[model samples]
Target: MFKKTMTTIGAGVALAAAGVLASGTAAFAHECFNPNRSEQGNAGASHSQAWLTVHIDELTAGLPEDDAECVLDAYAATGAPTSFTIMVKGAVGQDGTIASNNPHPEKAGDGSGIDEIFAAHGADIVGSFEECGVPMPF
Candidate 1:
């Protein structure tokens, strides 16, 4: 009886561990798309409207470190308040909408919202990054 109970408990623990591992992998998997990439259509026009989107929670998953830096740098470029905003407040659903807390009006998968925000505001946010003593990845 003791042996059987131990075996059952061990099996349950192993199954639970497997479940956790699978969920962890899924959590890291993110889908990134730029509908206006240079290869897609009009160069300038497409690039201008571009934004980067993922599960709002996984903004940097698929993107290269440099690309992520560039996105932040561009956000630094945007002035804000006077211009548009770029933020990741919530995940984009299959129906393609965001949470009410998300202030940006644009939909996901359009372009790098950071880029758009920078293009519109043209402010410098890198100062804060610099203050933090973190080197820019881009």
Candidate 2:
């Protein structure tokens, strides 16, 4: 029957498609040899480590508003990073300190990033960092 033939072809197509998708997912689940991933995903599973805690407050004695700050670490592919940046979200004054805080990082937004408050230290650098290499894909 024509209907049976169509069903058979459909099943074959589906099986082939599934195999391709599975292979693709397996390839990407780890790391793939894509030219665009040249930047680096993680610092490598095994390497160096560092930590910093930032603090925050009203730099001025009379301001009612409080501020948040960040402490960061620097790790180069081979050695310590000469310098790094803690990109402050929104507009924070120019005088903030880095430290560790409670509940670990209270990430801002949809948790796209993480934040560690040194609220206990009243704002001080108290976090760990690491540096590693980008592994080659299988």
Candidate 3:
């Protein structure tokens, strides 16, 4: 009986260890279009269109909120971001539109929303990448 108890306990410990290994190593496995942690839930895309890697993000106010020099490295078609064009909604909208200063408003992808804005720009984006310090996990 004692032998059996030890064997069972040992098996349980091994299984627990394996679970931790798998979950920790590949926690962020899904490919992200935006490099900025600020834009994690926002929409975007990654492709080889203009041979240019584009990265943009929406900050709570600024990328990394308090830090002035935060770099959000986006995953490029080649896999990583070089820079970003940050869009901040300074103005307001009546129903659902953000009265942004730029000529165009930003559109994050819905998967179905992929490259919708890019197609309109007449500018081809090659792929995107970025480099920001790790975001503070809430």
- Go through the candidates in order and give the clash count of each: 13, 23, 24
Q: Judge candidate 2 against the unseen true structure and give its global Cα lDDT, from 0 to 1.
A: 0.22
| Model 3 agreement with the true structure over 33-138: per-residue lDDT tens digits | 2333333333232122211222233211234453323423232232323333222211134222222222332343222222222222212121221233444221
All candidates: CA RMSD (Å): 18.8, 25.0, 20.1
Q: How much lDDT does candidate 3 score?
A: 0.28
Name the TM-score of candidate 3.
0.19
Number of the top candidate by TM-score?
A: 1
Tell me the spans in candidate 3 whose CA falls farther than 4 Å from its real position: 26-138
- lDDT (0 to 1) per candidate: 0.32, 0.22, 0.28
By summed lDDT, the worst window of 10 consecutive residues in model 1 runs over 25-34
TM-score to native of every candidate shown: 0.20, 0.19, 0.19
On the 0 to 100 scale, the lDDT of residue 53 in model 2 is 12
Off by over 4 Å in 1: 1-51, 54-115, 121-124
For model 1, residues 23-130, the per-residue Cα lDDT tens digits are 342211112223234433323322332322211112223457665565555544543221122222224552332222334434322345322322222124334335
